[model samples]
Target: MAGNSDPLSPRAKLAVTAGKAVAAASRAAGRGSGSVIGGRVALKLDPDLLARLAQNLDCVLVSATNGKTTTTRLIAEALRAAGPVVSNALGANMPAGITSALAGGSESKFGVIEVDEKYLAGVARDTDPKCIALLNLSRDQLDRAAETRMLAENWREGLAGSKAVIVANADDPLVVWAASSSPNVIWVAAGQMWKDDAWSCPSCGGVMQRPGDDWFCGECGFRRPTPSWALSGDHVLDPHGSAWPIHLQLPGRANKANAASSAAVAAVFGVPPQVALERMYQVQAVAGRYDVVQFEGRDLRLLLAKNPAGWLETFSLIDPPPTPVILSVNARGADGTDTSWLWDVDYTRLTGHPICVVGDRKLDLAVRLEVANQQFQVCENLDQAVQLCPPGRIEVIANYTAFQDLRRRVGN
Candidate 1:
């Protein structure tokens, strides 16, 4: 069990060294995205760098339209009970990000990776992970991700021939269908709050019957698989019908489901359920998802809402009677160029609440909120928007690029 006893081939070793040098230079130059650049250089030199580095490691791959980053962090923390764990905690989820994380943590025996939904299959195929956690799949970055169903199909095809044990959300038809073919699977009723993307059966193309929390297809009789783990309130029920209380510093029921999924993945590796849940409670924030930072003389709770589903879950986390909330949007490459998804969100939920829209696409959000008959103001800058809020702690929900910018500004 000595550290990375197998040395890389000379060529691959040189690639890693050069990539590290570039990463150092990029960091010194104040480029925060050095991981991507360094990984790109290493992969360009050695196409199979990720596979080589991942060899002989117990790896867990996590993917979903949302919650993948937080879930990955939770699983990584839980796995620390076993030994050292390497993960992409910086939100670099693509192949380059995975490569960067693996290269940096070469000595670690365990890896927990947050694979982008689009790159799940490719990364899984390369890493040959021992376990794969498939969280709920919903529409995200319509312009970039295309469609939810198509991505699920891609995942089904990509995971072919793999012997990995699959941990999947049973409530989501798309997740169920995508993972059905896997030989070994652990199902968890992690709860799916957004159902627009899963209204129809992915298999029979028939209308699904969602009576209470369970769903079934009327046409093909495809129904929700019996779950080995179920979330009841704040407790996760094990197969033996015992409940384990989950305490997390992160807010929302969505995070509870995330913790349940992480605990299931930990079980696959023989980590006790209580141990997994205990380790997860230690995680205060994943990147900057739920960190309260001082900004513009007000405490701002940073929440990331990239799609309609994300918005729905994030809105539920807002305190009732609605405190002042700042909504920021951006149509940058990472945020997806299509701002039309704004119309898909049920902004009506915020009916009597005070909202201030900011970011480059603030006008678009203004129109959406206005059409919903919600009261909101438009601000050109995030600081001005924060200033408009009534004193005390304010909730700030933002899309990808805007969220990153605010996190950088808050120095979180």
Candidate 2:
């Protein structure tokens, strides 16, 4: 591994193999149960070193069960409108990844980053951000997160003494309960909607009673506070029609929370709400999250659904195509080795839909599709699937690992 003092020349720095070697050596320092999470180093050496290099730069950290990436990107953009900024906008939420992003910057007033829940505490400790944005906690990555309560505890302990102002989503009851004890917390929420879900209380384990999309714990009666900040008004104008437009570059209910969280962070930084809203519309896609691209004559949308919550969100986005749609699933490490999460998704949304299935897990995805009564054509591989489709015009949904693998294979 290259020592901090052994600065390599620009030509040598461009070598990918050498860089990976250095990263591996850096990983070696904190051995046994101290592996890097969200790309931030475990020993705290790298971030501290990098922070000193940048002269204790002001920073913002965004953490959530979902929408961290999109929210982080939007916050970074809004901050950028004020000045230059650094962030893990590419989805590297661990310590080492945070180091990599900070290392890439020259100088900035703020380092805006999206942190994974598991690594949030450590990164928060090391980075010591000036602002922390907590989006709602939903059940995600049962294999990794274990349960939402575990994560809530992690945040509770991790952020115990943080001087940084806390921004939380009021719509998520779990977040509301957690922030109730926070010293300097601000709430952001989404209004009631027709397609809304998650009305359960995280406290006292009871079904929540909603008074117009506003939830109160049945057993504990812990009511959510109105938001200090929100993403949209009563309604917004979509191309189709006006509905509460999230004003984010991405689509869906989850993304709205992401947008609102970003706005909350921007507001904390003293960026005018109007300026934040205006800049949000200018932000671009964060790659595989919900990136749409054009092929031959078809519109291809690619989403990286890594776990049950993400999978359900992606499945819900699949509109009944006027034409046949193609769905692919892969078990590549990026998508995840365990494909059991497939059973948890509400594949019923695909019922009566025309579609095709492909990838190593094609048969498995097909079985799930069959349960929905969706007709599917089998393809030997992704290449075969894309060839079968009209090049540029098809919808492609894959888990995280599969999304990256397909992107490399298809040259997207």
Candidate 3:
């Protein structure tokens, strides 16, 4: 219950010190980055540490089923143009990890935090961010996280009391329903490509209606709001009728939408849209998501996609046909033990590409790819798959834990 500007209680100060020590020890032990474990230790000692540390900083929280990490990085980098900014840039997004990131950047003038979908409400309550970016919502980690609509309703209810200006996606029905009733909201037509989870209205439980550029409930008349900012083809048009070209180093239309919402969030803190985006032109990757690591004359590019919606977006980012893409999957706790979601992905999109599968759940992927009438080779690991084909740019796509394995192997 203490603020950063206010004198910290002796107990709280001790907890912060202990957390840093543990994080340092974790690095020395070579266990991991120690962000999560360090914060866990701090939370056990003082549950109010996040609130105390984040109280005085102007924070921006970005939450979604995908793109949270990259968008957070963009917003934080953009804010660097205005002043000093700190963020959970490595994707340690929960409360404990959030605390750890803020712990080290006490002198930062701004805070940009990425929040997991279910944890957004609590983080917003503590940080009371100046602006909150609500991107699209889709079925992700259904076995471990809440159901799609349930998560949206929770967001709707939890955000009712928030004073932060909400910058929400107008194209996503779930995000629209959640942020609609808020007193302050800036709508951006950031797209939602996978409509499987959004066909039903969150408010009325009716089939959604899409008559051209707009969506409304077939039964209840809850319609999509007009966006103040929209991603029009390759350009992002702001409220003043000014259009900025979207020439980002990050690939895909999904990230273009991220750039739109990010510029909107940054503008809330007095940074111009073009100024913010110009600063982000240097970012080519985020936490190794779109990293290129070349070895043995094989140009290997790593791409991470955890769910059906994510896979759909990732397919657009991979190189052209016969590029020899290695598909990997895992059913670890981090990736949700149930691999049933694999059925929803249309693997046939990789028809012309030479596909090689690997990971703990490679068998599941093989079956799914088979049923889709697509040809794929099941392999043991990245090297085995790469050896089978003549590769220039080898595309590697994996889920959460599996992606971490690939990252470690490449020394990323």
Question: How would you encode candidate 2's per-residue C-alpha lDDT over 279-366 as one tens digit per residue?
Answer: 8887667765566766545667777666666666666555565445666677764444667767777776666655778777888988
- List where candidate 2 sits over 4 angstroms from the true fold: 1-47, 50-55, 191-200, 233-249, 294-297, 315-320, 332-335, 390-392
lDDT of 3: 0.89
Candidate 1 global CA lDDT score: 0.90
Candidates in order, TM-scores: namely 0.97, 0.80, 0.98
Candidate 1 vs 2: which has more lDDT:
1
Prediction 2 global C-alpha lDDT? 0.65
Q: Which window of ten consecutive residues has the lowest lDDT sum in model 3?
A: 1-10
Displacement of residue 233 (Cα, Å) in model 3 is 1.8
Number of the candidate with higher TM-score, 1 or 2: 1
Q: Can you give the lDDT of residue 144 in candidate 2?
A: 47
Q: In model 3, which runs have C-alpha deviations exceeding 4 angstroms?
A: 1-4
Clashing pairs in 1: none
lDDT of 1 by residue, 1-412 (tens): 2234678888888888888889889999998858998999999999999988888589999999999999999999999999899999888999987898889897687989999988999998889899999998988887877588898898888886779999999989999999998888899999999999988989979999999998999999999999999888999998899999999999999999999999899998889899999999999987888999887778899999999999999999987655888899999998899999999999988876788988989889999988999988998788788878877888889999999988887788
* TM-score, structure 3 vs. true: 0.98
